[model samples]
Target: MNERRKLLLHEKVEVRQLEEGLGGSWHPGIVIGVSESCRKVRYDELLCDTGKSKLIESIPVTGAIEGLYQRPFVKSNYRGRIRPRPPSPEHFDVKTSLSFGVCVDVLFKEAWWEGVIFDYNEGGDERCVFFPDEGDERKFKLTDIRATLEWDEFSGHWRERGVWTLVSLAKEHKKEGHIFQLVKRIWSRLKVHYGFMKMISEWTCGAYCLW
Candidate 1:
């Protein structure tokens, strides 16, 4: 919170901005300048600014020192709203250890690439042991490793038009005695009668099964 008051020009920070006639959310931007007259700040976008320096505190993080907030409190008992917690490196680290071999997207030189975490480096910095699709094996810092939802999974889960079922769908997918049953029944008998099957194939264009 005190560091928020001491925000310097050109300092990069993730800030919350509420816009007029629009929604509010957190965004990453550089602090272009600070208002000398007031506690406002000038950052990206026309109207986004920092709030009261003293009040712009993060939710208390365990082991975090007082007077500064890097992340917001995830739960608010008084407001009765569960605030989303910012992504933590510790969570990712634990996930890497628990869920090894899971596909992950790693950021390298500003570009995201598909990879898997096989191991971790035994160093002061938490570097990931990554195997990329390009056949390059290397260790990366946590800041450079990010996990994004798989595109196919995201589409299937969100659009509901894909092959995978993402949610608890109550509606049954199969119905008894559907129209195609008649076609299947006929085709089964026809194939058994070789002469009839030959004649039918010659008579009709072709047999096609509907999904």
Candidate 2:
């Protein structure tokens, strides 16, 4: 099996004004790595995460080298305390869920293993020949991917919502078994359902709805 080599490049990031009351001022830092799915950019020169940090800051990625290995996708972590409910207590309180969305442009390369082609002989003896899998050869093109983040204060949790888009040349040519559009639709439904459930549970205090 042949392994593909990943490329790396060094880059710098500068943060301007982020938002009011969000904490922290504009700062500069370094971007160490880029993966097929995520970008790892860190900054400590300005101590933005410090308790005293306030105000919003935007980090600009420019003049960055091309073909850097991106970071892997990881689930966002949420930590909060949930208020306990008293059994046989007073009236219930209505809760509302908070959510935000952001759009991003990502470029990554992914490879899949396709099946091999076999050749057989007409005689009693069978000969098998394997051809390089064409299904695995592809460059996924994604644009204007929208990602959302939702926080359930009542449940003390946060979740992500969105269906990422990917364009596959092999799928367009009908050489691959799966269609990119179909896959994206299915994924979208799943994300939407999960997000809705999270909101409903928080609002109704774990009430189940039919339909």
TM-score of 1: 0.26
Over 4 Å off, model 1? 1-99, 120-124, 152-211
Clashes of each: 3, 14
Cα deviation of 58 in candidate 2 (Å)?
A: 12
Cα lDDT tens digits for candidate 2, 51-155: 564323332222112222443232233211111111111232223111111111111211111111122121323222211111121222222111222333323
- lDDT leader: 1
The local distance difference test score of each candidate is: 0.33, 0.27
Model 2 / residue 158 / CA error / Å? 38
Off by over 4 Å in 2: 1-8, 21-26, 48-211
lDDT per residue, candidate 1, 153-210, as tens digits? 1111211111111000101333333423333344455546776544333211112220
Residue pairs in steric clash, candidate 1?
1-68, 59-72, 59-73
